[model samples]
Target: MRILFEDSPDYEMVLGDYLERIPISWSRDESFGLLKTRLVAEPETTRDLAEKVMDNREKGGELAGSLLSAIAETSEGQDWMFESLTSGNVRKEASALVMLLNLISSITEPNLDHNLRLLKANAQSVSEDNTHLLLWCLEEACEKERDIFVPLLEEVLRTRGVPAASVYLSRPSLHRERPVSALVLAVEILEEKGLDNGEISLGLIGIYPKNREFVLERLKRWISKGKFPDSHHGMLVAHLKKHDTSPIIALIEELIDSGNRNALYVAANCLEELTQSISEWLGWCEKWESDSNKEPAVIRSLLEILSRLKTYEASGDRIRAIELVQKFASRSNIDYEDSTKHISLGKYSHEGCANTRQENRYTLKRP
Candidate 1:
């Protein structure tokens, strides 16, 4: 088979014929040994053979399992498999890699420590298409060896960024073993790249309640540096609600003061999240009203916050929030015409007040 793979003009078709004959003509152990040798010498060929075996297994060929097991046990076979992962540059070998990972994962006695180390080493060259394969292989290997794989997991997260990194970090099973390392790597990625995607941000926030100080502090630092994107503010606020709202409230206020449109948008969402606490809403409204140099952006954000309040059930806090909106609007020299369109203070009138009792009934239209 090895000679055919190297020397034959029509190697692929001949190799396919040889693979089909292995189960019928050879003993299980001999077939396994021959496939392993072929795998190390010609990975791409063996990958084709392995796929044939897998397809045959689906049809009840028992020798496929033995072939895969032999490949998993040999160091050379593992190396060949990893090499096959990166061999296709133009189009990734996704199907073959998936089969390879499945084979490696099925071994009852896998050399996971060595395999994980090799995976970590290979992870440095990962491209977009092969990332999922690498992560799946890492996850399977890590399941067998946590202590050895955790650092490698962090390395993969650091090198691959969030889309792939989130798979390992977001898994509930591995959260207890050095999750902070993954969190810190995520923070570093955020600092370097900003919130290009929400996967890492959401992953961090998903684990925030568990790792409060570390996650919150990093979130705050990212927000302060203008690292987080505006679109992500809503997700951050939603997760922040699970922890103490005080720091999150303070962060939102700071963001409102930053005069950033996205930050103010996030602040509005955060305030809406905090609106269940009327005192906090009232306090923020009062604070914004007292400031003489309220930026139009801040005022607009404040108006959104007040408009959200109109949705609250009729309570003293709701009334105070409405009054605060009117006062803030008046102080900002926003007339009834302007206020009605943007702030919707007309909602506070008798007719408007009557309709505020229903859940999510009030929709704030900010100009």
Candidate 2:
């Protein structure tokens, strides 16, 4: 049972002991015992995994993860595990490395070195399944990013059937902090695959405009169509390196005037870039204050942006915003408008910092 096969896939295959030559291999019971006795990456997750694996006996990821984790506790055990996984790599089987990725979270890994060797082997994936595993590792690499991760990501993108990877890399990322280098290359790959994604435009944030104009052009269309949002991406337009922002600004103003609550949030979110339109913001504040049917979110965004003027290094704007606050509070015609003395402040409490602008180039004309 202790004999290790040089070809790792042989372990996954069933042997006919009666017709074939007899050989000692680990019994299924023995292997299962080893995995059951060994600890896994995450306890809470492992418990759920164990339940799922029990319900369906075919899933081997948790079993493999358990076995690897148990064996890799010791230096000698780790060496053997690495060697066996390397054999799987030589065979171009993802079974071993899939186990590695399974041990880690879908999001990130706490200790990347534990899987570094397997990850490097996966850079040149042998099949579609192998490339899928590479994308999983790429997500982890992007999460707890390092200098080595970028090259690894590039290699993964260069895999024979890279278009399959675009489905994932081109999706919207909720995380504000993302690996820009990997994402930039990912956007290029997505572009090559002809996958036009408005939600994925954030990946193009810091890409030089001269490097690719089509992406920016597509983003402008999405923004105009409201497929891509400006609310969360305050710095997106600036990062696009477009000298003519007037068209984009007009599109944004159209959204704001459309009376969409979320659009107001977008205006609030992008007030820094929209500072040139201070008069417009003031007008909106006055309009909202005078109207009896205003939503609290609307007022919240207005006040929030005004409150943020303190951090904007613009004294005139700050004073004007403050006075508007006082005037809005003083207005006795509306119900609870004064209670909003702090009503707008109550909805969200956000910290402020100097707006960061990274230089990127793209020529955009509002179509």
Candidate 3:
């Protein structure tokens, strides 16, 4: 049980005070006697007691081994010890649990299955005040006993939402083989519970690339119903741009012709993502320009795209886009001021602008 608390000054200081409160009689047990005594004294406090014991430095390993033997001797002793150690403030309880877990693992040939189950059960009872420690314990359990810890991980995601679940799910080990069932449930919870867009984006990103089809279908359904909020438009577009550009492109085109200013901006941004080159973007402008039914909103979207290209420092692309914009303005008999005002020049270059272009250029041709 080599807990890495020696380097933590706060843990050491807290442990020093915590140990002094425990009666020396508690150290009388031969297995834990020396460890309890040394922990109560000076100089040994600064030393890496856990590491020294594991290394057998000056019989430290023997002392540590005895402590484990004592802990494993009976379920009653283990239960009492755990309850006693954790009956403190949040910091104290966390440190005690961490140390206890390490001690259990350090003993040679220790039976860990039962102890791990106890830890998992304790983890479920943690309150918000001790969530950080609970997450740490869960991660440790994942490393030590993945099969047992996975269900607990799902429970955390289900009850606590993405803020707590992401701490564990984002880990490479879990992220690579993310529990899709849990993630899908989380998405449903997030949607029904109405979490912040940022949190929703985090949840989506955590399960991204793997769940592209699932996400795209959701976005499509949302867009078709005109239920997709502007808050999610950017993140949804970003994720869609990565895996499936067709839906994004179609959505952008539909929104551009819908005559909604906000939706048009969202469409313009999506167009910037889907466009491969200045020539390709110009082609879209030409198509819209030639359309007899193209609305003022479509022209506005084209101007917005041009402004974004300039902001991106795509000088050549900007020039070509600007040329198309000027042609549209001239044909409509609209002056530069109206064009600039309609396009909202200099606004789309920054992040807050609804019409800002994405930097990621896709090579996939539009379907």
Return the TM-score for each candidate structure. 0.50, 0.41, 0.52
Candidate 1 residues 126-232, lDDT tens each? 56655665666665666667676667767777767766665554444422343556666765676576554565565666557667777667656655555543575
Q: Which runs of model 2 end up more than 4 angstroms from their true locations?
A: 1-59, 75-80, 83-95, 98-118, 138-145, 160-164, 167-177, 198-218, 224-367
Top candidate on lDDT is 1
User: What are the runs in model 3 whose C-alpha is more than 4 Å off?
Assistant: 1-89, 96-115, 139-147, 160-177, 217-244, 254-262, 273-298, 301-319, 326-367
Clashes of each: 0, 4, 2
Give the per-residue lDDT digits (tens) of candidate 3, residues 242-307. 564666556645654665455444444444555665466566666677654444435665667655
Q: Is candidate 2 or candidate 3 better by lDDT?
A: 3
The predicted structure with the larger TM-score, 1 or 3, is 3
How many backbone collisions does model 2 have? 4
> How far out, in Å, is residue 106 in model 3?
13
Candidate 2 lDDT by residue in tens digits, 1-367: 4432221223323211210122111121244443334233334433343233323334343243333443333454345445545554322133344445534433333445666655666456345544555565566566555577766766666554346446445444444555566666667666677656542455665343443454556554554444554454545656643455445545555655666545444544343453356665555555556554443433565567665554523255455555555555556454333343342222333432222000000111112
* Over 4 Å off, model 1: 1-129, 156-178, 186-190, 193-196, 206-229, 252-266, 273-280, 286-302, 305-314, 325-367
